[model samples]
Target: MLIPFLIMLREGIEAALIVGIIASYLVQSGRRHLIPAIWIGVLLAAALSLFAGAALQWLSAEFPQKQQEFFEGVVGLVAVAMLTSMVFWMKKSARTLKRRLQDSVEHAVHDHPGSGQGWALIGMVFLAVAREGLESIFFLLAIFQQSRDWAAPLGALAGILVSILIGYGLYSGGVRLDLRRFFRLTGMFILLVAAGLLAGVLRKFHEAGVWNHLQQVVFDLNDTLPMDSPLGTVLSGLFGYQAAPVLGEVIAYVLFLTISLACFLRASTPDTSAGAPTGTAMPAVTSPAASSPASNA
Candidate 1:
């Protein structure tokens, strides 16, 4: 549940931030007429996300046990791929995202600066919302395989809605946020989630007879962290906590977390300069009714 919630929170925040950035840019630049298109795009994307999530859940339950494992394994791998790319993409593009977004908007508007503003605006909103929405669906599906419960999805939805409120507050000048810190903290959690996904993928593979070796039983911790216990269930929801992890799962989780965290932590540092590319940035932000500020980070 924690994993789903956090992932959805982060994902929703990104989408909201993108929309906010675009909206703020337009308002600041006296392009308020473009607002309607953005709204349309945002709503459409949200609907699409809901549809996709429901569809995936419904479709997956139709599979046989073996097929379910296969499907789970495939989705797990894809989720890891998407999750890692998202983190690194943010690290690489966080700095330049604003500039790129700005430039793209400008180019679109200029190329067709008349009624075409609607199209350009819609494009911006669609891409921004859809990107996050699609990612969330994939991540949530991967998470569902582990917990096989409805709470995960409910938690994710709640997380995303809460994130919208947070993004709204930040965008409306209610609070100043250090996105770097936010991502760093969440990134740590994401790493843990990814590690669990990694172990899950391995489990699925083994169940499907993909990798047959390294199946020795590791010391069982079910006695200590019984899955039925509240703490255990919470941990399992968030970090894919295992009561009796097999040797491979244990090794995979540790190795992936150690290596991924090392690289992720090194890359997780926020850009202090807005001039930097996606992963590298000067961390400059435009505050509402105030001068642009550069974070010390």
Candidate 2:
């Protein structure tokens, strides 16, 4: 639930920021007429995400037990990779994201010069939102399958609600943000989630009979870490806790965390090389949409 909450929050903000950039740029350019198209794109994306999630859930219910576990494991692993990469990608390129989105929009609009809700603009917005929305479906579905708890979706809903408020505030110049700090903190928590998911993947492989590396129990602590206990539940919910993990599971988990965290830290630190920005993804300098004409410095 924690992992899903954070993933949704970050993804929600990214999509919102991109859409806000487009809408703000349109208004600033006196192309407010295109605002309708923007909202249309957002609505369509929402519909697609909802439809996909519902349909997938329905399909999963029809699967046999083992098949269901296999499918869930694969999807969960994919979600972990996607969400992890997304965080770091945003960390590395968020500063450029606005410019890229802006450039794409500008190019599309330019190609269709003197446009009134031009097909190009409509398609651009649709593609942007739909892409993120579909990604969200995968993350949500993966988490839902793993926890099998209703709270997972509810937690995601709450996270998104909070993120939307924060995103809107940033867009409207109602508040200043420390996005660098934000990403750093959440990124750390997510790293733990990835470690847990890695263990989960191994469990699935064992269940599928693909890996028989460690059939013996490493140790059993279920007596103390009973799933019914609050702390144990939290650990289980976020880290795929196993009362008795095999040697293979332990090795995979430790190696994954060590390598993943090292990579993340290496990425987060300042790079003195050419054109590497000092901050995480941030608002543009001197853009009409920015709160001030000056840069953050």
Candidate 3:
């Protein structure tokens, strides 16, 4: 439950931030007429994401046990990839996000005047929302496959609701978020989650008879901390903890987390080179209002 909640919360916040930024830019730029297009795009993206998730779940249900493992393994791998890329991309782009968005809005409105403007806005917003929505879908799907808990969906729904409220607050100028700090912290958590998912993917593949090597037990803690225990269950859901992990799973989890965390932490160094990209100013830590429209991160 907690795992899905956090993943959805992060994903929801990202989508909300993008929509809020675009909407704010349109309104402030006197292009409020195109605002409805944003909603249209969001609705379309939501519909598509919902449909895709439902289809995948339905299809998985029809598969035999071995095939089910294969499907889950494939989805888990995709989720891991998407989650990792999202973390790194957000870390790199957060600073320039606002400016880049505003520039896109400007181009959308000014580059193609008339009806084309509305279409451009809709397309832009759709792609942005859809990307986040789809990422959430894959992440949640893999999580649900692993935990098989009824509470996971409810937790995810709660996260999305909270994110909507936060996005609204930011847009209304009633909330101030330290995006740099927020993303930095969440990025670390996501890397851990992704590492867990990657390990799970290996297990899934092995179950489907796709991976045969590294079959030896690295350690057995079933009696000490059985997976069925309450604490173990929670840990499994949140951090991919395994009581009797095999050698491969242990190696994969440790290696992925170590290298990913190293890269993520190292990127925290502020770029001071003279070749810094134009309009990539970092927003003030005091308020996202410093960047306008949405968070600077």
Candidate 4:
């Protein structure tokens, strides 16, 4: 539950920020007439995301037991890849995201001139929101398959709701957010989650009979704290905790965390020499339609 909630919260904020940047740029540039187009793009993207998620869920349900395990393993690997890319992309781009967004909007409006401008903006906004939405679906599917608890979806819903509120506050209510700090902390947490998912992926592969080598029992912590216990469930959901992990799973988990964290920390280190920016910071949206601006429309 907590895991899904945090993932959704972070993802929602990212979507909101994109929309906010675009919307703020539009208003500031006196292109407020295109606002409706932005909303239309958002709705369309959301609809598509829902349809895709539902289709995937239905399709997976048709698989046999072993096939299902294989499918889950594949999905888990994909999720890990996507999640890793997302973390690094944000870390690299967050500082300049606003400027880049503003430039793109300016180019879209100016390049297309009058009537065609609206359509161009709509396409842009659609792509932006839809990308985030689709990514969310994939992550949610992976988490849901692993957890299989009622609280998972509920936590996602709550996280999205709270993120919407936070986005709104950041856009219009004059709320200040230290985005650098927020992403840094959350990124670390997410890395841990991803590591757990990696181990789970290996486990799933073994279950599917694809990789059977190194199935040795690394250790047995079930006697100490079983995975099905109340506290254990929470840990398993959030951090991919296991009671009796296999040797391959443990090795994979440790290697993934060590390498991923090292890279993340190195990339995140600030360079303060000369004219370089001293710290990471995101632009503030001070307009009424700030949230809408990120829509690309």
Pick by lDDT: which candidate is best? 3
TM-score of each: 0.88, 0.89, 0.92, 0.94
Off by over 4 Å in 3: 274-297
lDDT of 1 by residue, 1-297 (tens): 667788989988778777777777787788888889989999888889889878877877898887878878888888887787788777677767778888877887788878888887797788788988888888888877676668887888899889888777766766566787677778777878888888989999888777777888888887777988999877777788888889999999999889988998877654556454444322444545654542323
lDDT of each: 0.78, 0.76, 0.85, 0.83
lDDT (tens digit, per residue) of candidate 2 on 112-146: 87654467777888888887787778778877777
In angstroms, how far off is 176's CA in candidate 2? Answer: 1.4
Tens-digit per-residue lDDT, 1-297, candidate 4: 888888889988988888877876787778889988788888889999999999988978999988898888888888888788888889988767888888888888889988878888889989988987888888888998986769999999999999888887776646677777788788888899999999999988898889898899988989888998998888898889999999898999899999999999998888676455765465555556444322211
C-alpha root-mean-square deviation, each candidate: 3.2, 2.6, 3.0, 3.3
Compare the candidates by TM-score and give the number of the best one. Answer: 4
Candidate 1 has an lDDT of 0.78
TM-score-sorted candidate list, best first: 4, 3, 2, 1
lDDT of model 4, residue 177: 79
Judged by lDDT against the true structure, how good is candidate 2? 0.76
- Give the lDDT of residue 278 in candidate 1: 47
Q: Model 4, residue 126: what's the lDDT?
A: 92
In model 1, the runs with Cα more than 4 Å from the true position are: 148-150, 269-297
- Which lDDT value does model 3 have at 295? 42
Q: What ranking emerges by lDDT with the best candidate at the front?
A: 3, 4, 1, 2
